[model samples]
Target: MKILQAPFTEEMMRSLRVGDEVAINGVVYTGRDAVHKYLHEGGELPPGVNLRDGIIYHCGPVVMKEANGDWKVTAAGPTTSIREEPYQGQIIRDFGVRGVIGKGGMGDRTLAACAAHGCVYLHAIGGAAQVLAECVKRVRNVYLLEKFGSPEAIWELEVENFPAVVTMDSHGGSLHAEVLRHSQAALAERV
Candidate 1:
């Protein structure tokens, strides 16, 4: 398994290819549809939040607040990624996002952005929220809690060995497209 650490750089992102298993050790921000739309329309990230060469996980985590006001993540599964296809490319370009973590996959526009911007799309396991939350080491900070609420808020998370697989690479490779092409060919033959 390839190890991806903090300060994820262009070279590191480019080195990853489709089907590569990776364990990410660093900070990843939780972003849902609300976050995507907000950023797409030029909304500012919470102060001190930057996406330059950073990873954005498409998740609406299940979080619980503890005494002393510390938050704990009870579930952290990946959300369907295709829904963000419209804004993903733009977000990747505009914010310099190096990696995206989500379930399923994205379309050509996002793939093109990854190719152009040295970014990669990492596919996390679906239906594995509780298991995935084990990788989260800390809940550093959260933003937009008032406007977007917990699920849709910007959650800054520190993680360790968060496992994922590269489904789309910066070199114009997409496992999702491959699956679609193969499925189409099989359907044509059957008909």
Candidate 2:
């Protein structure tokens, strides 16, 4: 298993390939469709949050507030990545994002973007919300909570040993596309 820390460099992204298991450490930001749309439409991010060479998580975590007024992530699972395909490529380029964590994979546009922009897409296990939450060590801050609500808000999180597999790579490798192609061929043969 490969270990990756935040503020990934271009060389780091290029070294990854589809099917590589990875353990991620450091900060990651959460954003779903609403947050992506907001950013794509020119919404300004909250100050002090950086995206350059950063990791973006396609998640809507269940959060709770502690008595000390600190937020805790309860359940954090990856959302379907395809839903953000339209904006993902652009966002990756615009923000210099190096890694994306989500489930269900993405499309050709995103694949091409990864190739061009030195980014990778990591696939998290679906239905493992609670297990994933264990990786989150702390919630640093949350943005757009009032406008987008808890799930859709931008959550800045510090994590340790977050597990994922590389499903798309900067070299234009995509396990999802290969699987789809094989599945389609098998269906045709059965017909």
The lDDT of each candidate is: 0.95, 0.95
For model 2, residues 37-136, the per-residue Cα lDDT tens digits are: 9999999988977999999999999999999999999999999999999899999999999999999999999999999999999999988999899999
Highest TM-score model number: 2
Every model's TM-score: 0.97, 0.98
**In model 2, which regions exceed 4 Å deviation?**
none
Model 1 lDDT, residue 93, Cα: 94
Clash-forming residue pairs, model 1: none
Model 2 has an lDDT value of 0.95
Worst 10 residues of 1 by lDDT: 42-51
Number of clashes in every candidate structure? 0, 0
